[model samples]
Target chain A: MAQPLKFYFDFLNQSSRALYIFLEASKIPFEAIPISMLKGEHLTGEFRDKVNRFRKLPAITDHGYQLSENVAIFRHLAREKLVPEHWYPRRQLGRSRIDEYLAWQQTNMDVACTDYFQQKWLVPYLQKTRPAENAVNVAGKQLEHTLNDFEQLFLNSRKFMMGDNISFADLSAICEIDQPKSIGYNAFQNRNKLARWYEAVRDELGPYYKDVHGEFEAKLKQSGSSNQGVAQALKQ
Target chain B: MAQPLKFYFDFLNQSSRALYIFLEASKIPFEAIPISMLKGEHLTGEFRDKVNRFRKLPAITDHGYQLSENVAIFRHLAREKLVPEHWYPRRQLGRSRIDEYLAWQQTNMDVACTDYFQQKWLVPYLQKTRPAENAVNVAGKQLEHTLNDFEQLFLNSRKFMMGDNISFADLSAICEIDQPKSIGYNAFQNRNKLARWYEAVRDELGPYYKDVHGEFEAKLKQSGSSNQGVAQALKQ
Candidate 1:
């Protein structure tokens, strides 16, 4: 009997969703455990001390071997020969192409998305203060620039980020790119190629796509904001 | 004879220096080319239309093959089997351990250093504005938190970042961690574990250390400000 991989996830986080979709798609033996970032379970002693010290979400323990970071998890799975090589690519050039996107996105696209969320909700929801207009405007511009780069630099008419095949890079891109939607900003509004790529990924992920993002939409509808879980920090 | 690897570098950027030093240490056949950011060469048409579209430094050209981003470069070289296995590690687990650092640092340590530099120099040197007090304070706290994580989470008394032997992770960590020193911030001050790790990396890299970093020291000595060339944006 193979030991099941234990996945710790927070549904509110797109990083978590990306990994969850990836794990589910891999069809590997695993247990999915939801840890709420909104409720602040991530900071508790059990998670912080016993699991990930950095305390970010979407961590995995495969038969007592633990790993975090979406990129590392995908690579680890590939290295363990658990998932298809296409997800991470075994070829040097293919993996390098994916690596460039992985490295560039955290500092560029992800930061843009994070800043947008921070400006939109972090201040208003958490501090009970009006969102800084300048910060919101600045962050919005950054997000736009990142999206533009996504179109011009990576996507650029390719069926996927690394070309015809879908890798974890595409999975990561789709998840994070969907993040601004919590505040109702759809990156695909006017962009053609990006919109096409977004759809292709969704179609490929199948019903799991709806399961991951639709739940967020439902949460957004019910709660009126994705920032509420983090909002409690104001009292603390 | 094999074609030489073309390195496009700007001594102003420590990410460039890390790859530069690692390649030197690897004893790989390569040519080091400095593309001056000072003269606005990177933004020029030939450099952009033909080379890096993003116009960031630390790019490589090997036999007409083009690649950028420091991590991708290391992986490319390792895949080519040009460097020692220990630097990148052939084993999956070891590489995954290193990859975690590679992804984590860009967002944490690197951002902290960047923020501290911006606070200390960017606003005043070019913008003619007083440094933003809140921005500087925020950046300082972020740097402090990241440094704490570096010690408690990553290093944790290890000989190197990943394990006993030095890897590109150490080089990457050392280069970015040392950046603020150009502006006279010794992160090693008052820290024991990190200071020891800093010294260990310095001792290991040895003379090439002086060459890559000494240029920045010289630049700092001659210029007296860490953010001069970057300051030209204020004029624009």
Candidate 2:
């Protein structure tokens, strides 16, 4: 008998949450092995032997094959039709649009938003020191630029990045964008279309969203501290 | 009749060189349309409307399907055996390794090497004021770190990134690393193994490498400037 497909994830991570939501929504069977980065479990030697050079979480192993990186995993899963086919279209132009979004997001949304999360929550918590206002301002500016681009290019004409249906692109975006809200930015407050789209994504994700993201949100609130809380607590 | 596969390329680009070489070697017919970034051809309204939001070059159009980004195009073309089937293995581990290299390279080698190329060659030609030395130093450090990681992780044991055979991984690496050398860095001088691999890549590519890259190199030399030479020489 083949080993059950296993996903190594930490609920705290937005990337992992996106994949977890994806798998749950599609009703794919996989055992979840939680490797909490917050607890420094991911850096252990035993974990290192399993994952090798990657210090990041949210890896997947199936039939003894290990894979990392969210977009690649998302692509592999998307190929399995756990998500909408239009999420990674087979045609040239359609596929390129998806590819463009994936590539662009790494430097744009992923980097900027992650930086903001770290600055707003993680930095003050871990360092027990307030980050320079300029650092926070820089991250805020980057977030604004990315959000503006997302609105003008992606959310403007279509219901989703690719088209009318929800996609991994939308899921990926929502996960990162929502990070700010958890830390207190309220990204969807002023943007009506973005807010509507977020609701649609949450609706489509259904119970899967509740199961994975709900638990994580509970923990986040329980901590009563943003990344800063965790950081500051560690110092104490 | 279907429109012949049309490639918008500047041979100086690693991704374009890889694609052009692959197409030529495989005897897949493609029309090469040079879009010189140095001459600002890529920023033109005509190019923008046609290619859509992407500002980058090395885009391809096949029967009305337009695509940009090398990895996306490489994946599409590699499917047709312009390269090896194992270049993007369908299995989880094999595909992940390839995907890892592809994903890792974008922000790593691709961005770093491109910055180096621009600073070494393009900035002087294109920008009125040269970029600061510290900026150049930072870019150089990034390139070195990426190369070191490539050597330590991928190249240490395997003849290729996926092991024992050429794949798109080699193609992608060769293209970017070749950029610094073209601009007079002699990047492979101290790196004999990497040099040998590059030679092998060139040999594997055969006449196809010469036809596409050779033509572009000749044009670059003849013009002494970058895009100005290409634009002046090639009308359409």
Candidate 3:
């Protein structure tokens, strides 16, 4: 038997949740090794040595071979047929679009949404303190700009970013967008196409979303965090 | 005869320069289409529709096939043997490491460095006014952190990021580091290993760097920008 693939990530990370949903939806057998960034577990020397010395989470150790980066992991998993063939695109232009989305999202949507979550939810709820008001406002502005860009570039014409079929680009964007919703931002609620796409993603992921997101909600509730609206629904 | 490959970019961009240098060094036939971000060329509808409908640059059109993202372009070019075999590892693990570096750099080093360049140089220079002194100072601090991480994670152990061979990671990094140097920031000067590695990259590219960089520097000077030291050097 192949040594079990081990995924290392915190439950709260949007990228980690995206990967988690992918694995769960694919029905891949894997062991979860949670590395709590909040608890400083990733900073430990042992974890550093065993995993990437850089101490970045959302890494994976597959059959003793360690790999990092969501794009690489997604590509490996997709290559193994965990994702639909259309998701990874064999055509050069299609593949380039996927690469373009992935590259653009890292600094654009991902960073903006992550900053929003860190300020509005994580820092206040997890760290038990409020971030500076200006920081929060800046994050909100960034999030708005990112969503507008997404609306213009992605949701305008195609049913998905690439086409009618949902790809990793959709998955990546949906997970990050979900962050603000969990904090009661509701930015996507008014956007019809985006909202429809989110539902489709949730339906496809199904119980897997419950498993990854369910546990995350429980943690947030137990901490008595104010950002519990999304979590409360997940419990049911 | 094949229509020459059309490369679109702001020549001052490090990632763009890397591709330009690679194509030049390999003696690949291509036409340079400069996208002057300083003049808002990238945001224009004509450029957006042709290269990337999403309004991103550093894109390429080859045989009417349009593509974006530096990694995809690099891979495409490398597949054509414009890059050494070792630049993109063929074996599974080796290739994954390259992917890891490529992916991580986008979010970490690349973003950090670009942010610094924008805040420190571009915004003040192009806008023809200085930003807040505190903002520039903060950007400088963040850049220092990023450089320190680069030295620790990438430069410490291996001859290259992957070990014992020059790869695209080195090329990517050298281009970015060269930016600050162009503007009179000599972060690599005192760092012996980094300096040596940069020299190797410079030697590898040779006169190709001169042609692309020489034109880029001239354009910057012609723009009458007082903030760019690199442009000043080229003018002299």
Report every candidate's CA lDDT: 0.77, 0.71, 0.73
Clashes of each: 0, 6, 0
Give the C-alpha miss distance for residue A233 in model 3, angstroms: 14
Assess candidate 3 and give its TM-score to the true structure. Answer: 0.87
lDDT of 3 by residue, A83-104 (tens): 5666666564666677777887
Name the candidate that leads on lDDT.
1
Off by over 4 Å in 2: A1-3, A78-96, A222-236, B1-4, B78-87, B91-93, B128-131, B189-192, B215-236
Error of 1 at B137 (Å): 5.2
| Model 1 agreement with the true structure over B1-236: per-residue lDDT tens digits | 65467888987777888888888888877877788775678889988876677787888877776777777777887877468777878564788788888888877888898778777654455455556768767887888888888887788677887777889888998888777666656687667999999889899889988888989767645544444443332222
| DockQ of all models, two decimals each | 0.61, 0.43, 0.60
Candidate 3 regions exceeding 4 Å error are A1-4, A78-84, A130-134, A156-159, A225-236, B1-4, B26-28, B76-84, B129-134, B156-158, B220-236
lDDT of 1 by residue, A199-233 (tens): 88888889887898888666545444444543332
- For model 3, what is the alpha-carbon lDDT of residue A119? 75
Model 3: which residue pairs collide? Answer: none
Native-to-model Cα distance after best TM-score fit, residue A61 in candidate 1, in Å: 2.0
* Candidate 1 ranges beyond 4 A from true positions: A1-4, A121-135, A225-236, B1-4, B90-92, B121-138, B225-236
Per-residue lDDT over B84-147 for candidate 2, one digit per residue giving the tens place of the 0 to 100 score: 4655666535666777778878867888788886765566455544445676677777777777
